[model samples]
Target: MGRSGPAACGQTVAYGLAVGVALAATVQAAKADPLQDPYGTWTLQAENDAVSTLKGTSDQYYTSGLRFGWTSGTNNQPPAISNLNSFIWGPGTQRIAIGLQQLIFTPRQTQVSQPAPGDRPYAGVLLATVNLISDTDVTRSVAGIQAGVLGSYAGGYQVQNGFHSLISDTPNRGWSHQLPNQPILEIDAGRTWRLPLITRYGISADVLPEVSGEAGDFRTYAQIGGTVRIGQGLDSDFGTPRITPGLDGTDAYKATRPFVWYAFAGADGQAVAYDATLQGSTFRSGEPHVSKIWDVGEFEGGAAVLWHGFRLSYTQTWQTNEFQNSKALFNFGSVALSAKF
Candidate 1:
């Protein structure tokens, strides 16, 4: 599929916005104010994975049409590898946080030789997988991070040690499709400690296995970062507590709502780095250990608006890594709508 196809670049933007909007509306209501039962859930979907070739260091790399799902776990523990989800908190909203893991079916192509002089038919099969998500609340004085983990396995029906397969073959069009399942897992977590400084900023980080499977012989990295409030919370451009609608346009109510604040609104940009090493992974297939390590960094900025329980927001993610010698880049744009009950 083309990079701009419905399942590629364009799709990521569409979903990112959808999720952002939903979060904005929820946050607007609880801006700076802690609620009694501030809790909710949001689904997590993988939009796109775009990578550019870094001439000297890394080989051409990329993965597209990722998994889609909700989360299954607690506000504290990492999201489960299973397809399920519990509570979901918002990044902008301090109310509550939530996580998700979604299972999606992907179609793979197949080719066959025809006995006659005619074009052979192309067949495809479904690849089912589980995704992870983590959403938490960030109040004016406190912030909490979430995590999600996914590991690929086979023969899950058996209990003992049968759940560690990295490859599987299924019958399709009278042919066996041997698929190497990449066991990818993610660890996302964040915490905000109150500081004496007038400006409030807290560090956050996450870890991921660089190489699939072979846990012991794998690459791991962690992100260390913080976010700061640009000015006095009350004096930010978002608004002065009251909704000031525009003179023209229907974009009413101009107040820095909870989750829905424009890019560079009251909060400054956040910086995170990927710091990990190769440690090898455990796999059912038992291939020799693979060596993998990732060194990447990202700068993210966002703007959002919220009214009642409705939200709309936009966030841009700029990514750069050291693995490939040069630079590999990608961005995130999302739109979402949801309620907080």
Candidate 2:
């Protein structure tokens, strides 16, 4: 088997989980007070398009990421437009957080060998994000902005190849399929509405509607969707709960809990107006003899658990075929672990 195969994909995810577990253990042993509101958080996330046990030797892509976040009350406020701050963070009670993230992506054997041209290649990304959150009796919402850069020098290929070498008992070497350098920018806003029916069963349920846009060297697209979550508290767009500096005075709506968990499901559709990888552009030339499918849909379901400020979530996603000639229906698994301190 080549570098990009089901076996290689599985190895990548296992390696990521091993690293995450070690990090989690280190954090759990720290002396931070669990009862106090968290001033910061750290997260580890992984995504893989193929699992040998789930589906045999199919669509394969691997991604692993790590992020660190800091809240405003525990640190100085980030500079922003005065009016923009006032609009998103209402006067009542609010939270602001900044995050730094790193992500790596690699193509598989199936992807590289496919007849379709312009398939995504090995790449890595570094990003910074700012989020504004408001939680009150009458309203609950979040808005965010992100900026990032992607390139071969980001070391995605090196990481993946290193893990593969260790697992396959081979020496580290180079692989084909990679993307050109690029910059990314995005902004989004969303609101959640409590569902009265679910509250009767000791379940906190809500519907979230959101809209977002992105402009970047790789792709440009806009998305609108709604998600219904039946759980203990509101779920963030990225599948976690928003942690604030202060808790609501009421016992029914405390900000932090000793243990919490929820099940969630959602769907979204995207209008792909531009894709540098698919449609040749100035930033990067498009692949030859490739099929371009402009519209894509994604259906996702997942569950999350939180205990003593530690959170773990698992989500499975099914996405419609992205290319006209593609016979494979893309599916992937997402795992995220986070801790508050």
Candidate 3:
């Protein structure tokens, strides 16, 4: 029906999956390690709204994101951080991660330099985060803290327009009305449990359910959701690592088979308390703002492949509107490369 509709979703995911499968040809299978050991993996991820190959969708609202993260080997974490995490989340095998990310958002109409009334506000955010996670075969607990800045310091304008010029795409002209600079601090934690459904042949299936909360200037919300995944090596890791405000897993994983693969679908709903991008500057007087919707939902589908110790993943996401009178379905794609040592 629409560019962000199911037809587009299929084409987008089909295009998204090509690279991961291609990498499978380059890797040779080996013996998998233990099922529960995930240590020393690094992940690099990038997300954008330009994944069409079918019907191109407009690049607006959560248009771009980049993240890099590393998880520590089990028991090789910072003592103070790991101890505090174990104390709060309860004892289990523990690892800590460090991450850096930048995200950019814009209004539906980018044709004018001035702000579009009744549209999502323009905003940019950059954050550095620390995460500690504990795991057993069937359950996982995680806690995280992030600090960063919003607005120009995050370089939304320069990065977006620079890339646009490079690709000869239409320039986004609304950065003049972007949110004012503000410091941001956020903290979040959650727990997820795995329910084994069945294992047939070398393929298996499982459901991962979770509950989580976040609070601070960046965003405040409580969420509940679950993921259903099927493929080979279901016991290799928790789920998939993602930048949140939604469901996500971690990069930490070990080789449970010489070659591993899986496809997944997940959905989540959020009861939002506040969202800085939609509500505008926290402490400043003059900034763009919009009427925000308190409830939002997202649907996602994707796949991952790991050969030897290297992993590759692709995910496509569709989100409900976040602001008043918005037409966007928030279609986006995430591609990630990760490796375990």
Best candidate per TM-score, number? 3
**For each candidate, what is the lDDT?**
0.28, 0.52, 0.83
- Rank all candidate structures by their TM-score, best first, as comma-separated numbers: 3, 2, 1
Which is superior by TM-score, 1 or 3? 3
Q: What digit string (tens of lDDT, one per residue) describes model 2 on residues 1-341?
A: 46888989999999999999976754443223212232455555555554222563233433455456655432224445334656765442455667776666444343333322444344566678777765444344556777777666556666656766677744223234455667766665555433323575666776655455455554566666555667664432224432110010110122344567777777777777665434433354553324557787777777777676667776666667555554354666666666665
In Å, residue 222's CA in model 2 sits off its true spot by 2.1
Off by over 4 Å in 3: 1-39, 52-54
User: TM-score for every candidate vs. truth?
Assistant: 0.38, 0.68, 0.87
Candidate 3 colliding pairs: none
Q: What lDDT tens digits, residue by residue, belong to model 3 across residues 164-235?
A: 999898898888888989999999998877667999887799999989889999999999999999998877
Candidate 1 residues lying further than 4 Å off, grouped into runs, are: 1-33, 38-46, 49-99, 102-179, 182-188, 193-219, 228-260, 265-281, 284-294, 325-327, 332-337
How displaced is residue 52 in candidate 2, in Å? 9.6
| Quality of model 2 by C-alpha lDDT | 0.52
lDDT of 1 by residue, 232-328 (tens): 2222122111000000001112223343333231221222122111111234443212222244555544444554544343333445533333234
Instruction: Supply the TM-score for candidate 2.
Output: 0.68
lDDT of 1 at 85: 33
lDDT: which is higher, 1 or 2? 2
Ranking by lDDT: 3, 2, 1
